[model samples]
Target: MDKNHPKSISLTLAFSLTALIFYLPANFFPFMSIELYGNRNTSTIWGGIVVLVESGSWPIALIVFLASIVIPFFKLAILFYLALTATNGKHLQLKLKLYNITEAIGRWSMLDIFLLAVLVAILKLGPWTTVEPQMGSLLFALVVIFTMVASASFDPNLLKENPNGKVS
Candidate 1:
């Protein structure tokens, strides 16, 4: 669908901007709150991951950290780079690869959201060990969804070199 088209640039920018906006609150707010034995505590995404690591669940901790923090930031960076190059009509050889990777891994970012949802649903201990969704979880979920849409909407053809040795 005219991969190198201007529409692709617009889509990428829109996605990246939305993600960037959400990222701030996602990091600052708590992702989940737990109440146990009359004591209540809230955990941010990093805090949750730290708990997992401290409890000896390294794999899960790593996965959550990557999906929630690393991947989203990487995706945003890639999209911004792509958008910049696209606007200048500078054909980049790795455009296709970058776009594919962005789209492919976008859904993986949702892993954090899914985990939060599951925890909220399944971990209901009637005020003993309840898991409630936090503001950051909602923002993070929106970032993932918007980024996925943006990546999918981008056109790969924009990365192709023009006949005059120029981009697009």
Candidate 2:
């Protein structure tokens, strides 16, 4: 890897770490709030999944859980790992494969965001009902964006570099 490659790797790791930082609040804080006839219902990502399971929508819940929670976390972890090990001169093929897979699956992480948008759009009623995204949605979106950027920023070539800064 060249000198600039190290900077690129560091940038990727930084973004991955930033996404991880955002991921916590994104899962715990309220993602959306619905107010109907003066009654308010607020839900975080996990809370929404539980509601879905309670309502016998386990499949949809699983989809949401995977897209929102599992996939994003996986992408971040993979990207962070790749960035950290880029110059270690080991597992080059495996690191490249992981990076490619992470990039390929990155779009699926936005599934939750699109679903929330559709829900908010479909459930918007007149004065009696309102659906608004909460802080968690914004934070979650950031996590997705940062992870995607981090994945994209990763240079597979780094995996070919030796620890002494020589390309294999």
Which candidate number maximizes TM-score?
2
In the order shown, the candidates' Cα RMSDs to the true structure are: 2.8, 2.4
Backbone clash pairs for candidate 1 read 3-155, 3-157, 3-158, 4-157, 4-158, 89-167, 91-167
| List of clashing residue pairs for candidate 2 | none
Write one digit per residue (lDDT tens) for candidate 2, span 1-168: 467675788889899999999999999999999998999999999999999999999999999998988888888888888887777777778988898899789768788889989988888846688999999999999999998888878877777755765654
Q: Could you estimate the TM-score for every candidate?
A: 0.86, 0.91
lDDT agreement of model 1 with the native: 0.80
Model 1: lowest-lDDT 10 consecutive positions:
86-95
lDDT of each: 0.80, 0.87
- The alpha-carbon lDDT assigned to residue 82 of candidate 2 equals 85
In terms of lDDT, the best-performing candidate is 2
